[model samples]
Target: MEHILHVTLPEATARAGKEIDQLTVIMDMQGLGLKHLSPSWLSLVGEAVTVIESNYPEVLGACFVINAPPLFSRLYSLVKPLLSKATQEKVQVLDSNYPETLLQHCDAESLPAVYGGSLIDPDGDPSCPSRICWAGPVPDSQINQSKQPHAPPPVIRVALSRSASAQSLGSSEQFSVVEVARGGQRDIPVGFLPVGVELSWCVVVFAKSFLSCL
Candidate 1:
């Protein structure tokens, strides 16, 4: 899962890493491969991996990237050189031929029905007997509870400038949907300024190319 940027990663510590390592061992008993579908994998940004490696090093035993489209290969090549040898060895990229690979790691019954598994995909055909197979981390109480709709957050608009190698914006600027080509980077000023004012912000990615902070 892509982390909400505002939710800070836990500070790196030997104890925390040990706890995560223990959890990884438990997940190994039943398998915990991440089955990502195509197109969505394009949103797998470098910062996400950095967070994982920095705070929870060696937590993932394997990563099953399934059903990646042709363009995924180009993206992979662009990033392959940047990944460490160990990290590269842990990733298993699969194309349409993913069922067999998935079965090798995950049991058919535990797999999602949309991927030819016994369990129904939550977003699968509604006519199926058990379409809503998973409800995720939301508890049943919260799911069944009735709540009033909350007001939406206000949107901020900003002007952007294009330059070679990197894109930039003023500290006061806020923007969305600025596409920086593969291998390019951008710099935007952010965060608290009054020495120790305890500032916080959140980044929500509404689209593959869109990012907004509040």
Candidate 2:
């Protein structure tokens, strides 16, 4: 049976110590969840790839869902000082993109894909108010040949709700969310929105075969 694991950073932290307790709770919950879902399945929360490897060695690849802003703010402080002013400005602009940028850094091909929606009142129909992203069937041959660490499994799909948006991107209808392949050349329509609503972007990732033990 295939396993699905979702990892979320629940708190914003400027220091490692501040995150320890949250991390511990997350890990414990993960273990409990795994026990309930067990036999061949496991799941865990990880703040970084290394943490995932060390703590949940049996897990498949992880889906990182970051909601806090301070995490990036702290990251910017570490690197911005080394870059030129223009470069710094560009980085800031990109930084404002938030969770989308973080997911993209994990894998270039991640796109905005919707996973769930709510039914509008009165008519009791459905409407998508979130963006989704996913990548899958990652290339094994390429992974084996790369000098960098093996890539995670393809993200089949990830949906971000309207509440997740960092800022108003204008009316939701104005921005149509679609899937873009790596290199940003192709687009596949996934969902739609009304004339004035926007959604937080999300990424779907795929896990490598070896990482699938969990």
Candidate 3:
């Protein structure tokens, strides 16, 4: 980060000879999973995001977070409040259709074919292993095994008043997925929830599993 701020930025700006130019930042979080939510990993990521947004607000032209998985929202929310409003406005979280959107901002040749662009690796690898590094899931060797396995938090039943925006009328809410091991069951006590309240949820299970909403 220090090298990028002092050396990379200066050299790139000088080569381009454009005072108004800015760098485009792209973050792809396709394979991020529960394992990444470790305290140490989260702290490091939060600090980096806060520092870049706070210090180099002007250096970034725009930020595109593409191929965002379901858990990305929860992770992003942790750091979103720390960023300035200007930085927030520059960020766009996109789904699978981001390839077309990215092409609109830059030339096809500028991007690698792996991301729906014309650029290709000399060795015919679409991901361009020679030029760009692709990050994979963390190996067991690096993960901290000290995390205490705690039960998932129970959901709160939010009863809507007449003035309250109807859940149907409101936009979709982001919910995190909880994993249940074999022969294990987790309960979300909502039997007493008022009639007016609606509960929306999703569950992800491994092979040969079932869910009982009751």
Candidate 4:
């Protein structure tokens, strides 16, 4: 949130000749969990919305939310009342097949390859890690406990492996980063080796999560 208000807004402003300009926002809600619906979380969203509407009204050109689950609609319902009519009109919930829709507003060269764009990271990463800041997992200790415990909040839950990162163990192996949609799973094909031959794989769930499986 701080990054969006401080860094993103400033960059967009400068790009628009130092005046506030319309900006497009694309959010990947791939790993949204039940914790996101808590009152504490919702209030933080309310706070951000308040700041944006009060200070930067009509700054959004369009806001695209890709890879969003059905539960996201419920979350939006709670937030709908907070948004002005113009801002509400700008919000769009899209499926994983958002690349084609987004291409209508942006050129393929202007976007990263992960979003069906031609621009790929120099390190061969399609997700373009250098251009986008991927979020690391948050720790339980850092989580804010709800202060208004008496107030009831709607319940929701989801758990699905959306993607995986693989490390090449052999010189002949080629690998690249890819994003999987919610409720979608990616299969990494492993070739059959002779009885005398050995094969190895290094799968990283996420760098910050420190989870891996062979």
Per-candidate Cα lDDT values, in order, are 0.49, 0.34, 0.70, 0.71
Candidate maximizing TM-score: 3
TM-score order, best first, reads 3, 4, 1, 2
Which pairs of residues collide in model 3? none
Q: Per-residue alpha-carbon lDDT of model 4 for 46-65, expressed as tens digits?
A: 99888888878766889999
TM-score computed on alpha carbons, candidate 3: 0.58
Indicate whether candidate 2 or candidate 3 has the larger TM-score: 3
lDDT of 1: 0.49
lDDT of 2 by residue, 53-109 (tens): 445544332223233243445443544454444333332233233445444333322
Worst 10 residues of 1 by lDDT: 21-30
Candidate 2 vs 3: which has more lDDT: 3
State the lDDT of candidate 3 residue by residue for 8-32, as single tens digits.
7788778758653477777988788
Better of 2 and 4 by TM-score: 4
Tens digits of per-residue lDDT, candidate 1, 1-214, equal 2342223223223324632221111111112224433445535655666666666555566677755555566667866765677777878776666667777766576566656567753556532447333423556776746677745544454333332112334344444324444456665454334433333333333345655534
* Model 4 segments more than 4 A misplaced: 1-20, 138-214
Stretches of candidate 2 exceeding 4 Å from the true structure = 1-68, 93-111, 114-214
- Give per-model TM-scores: 0.40, 0.17, 0.58, 0.57
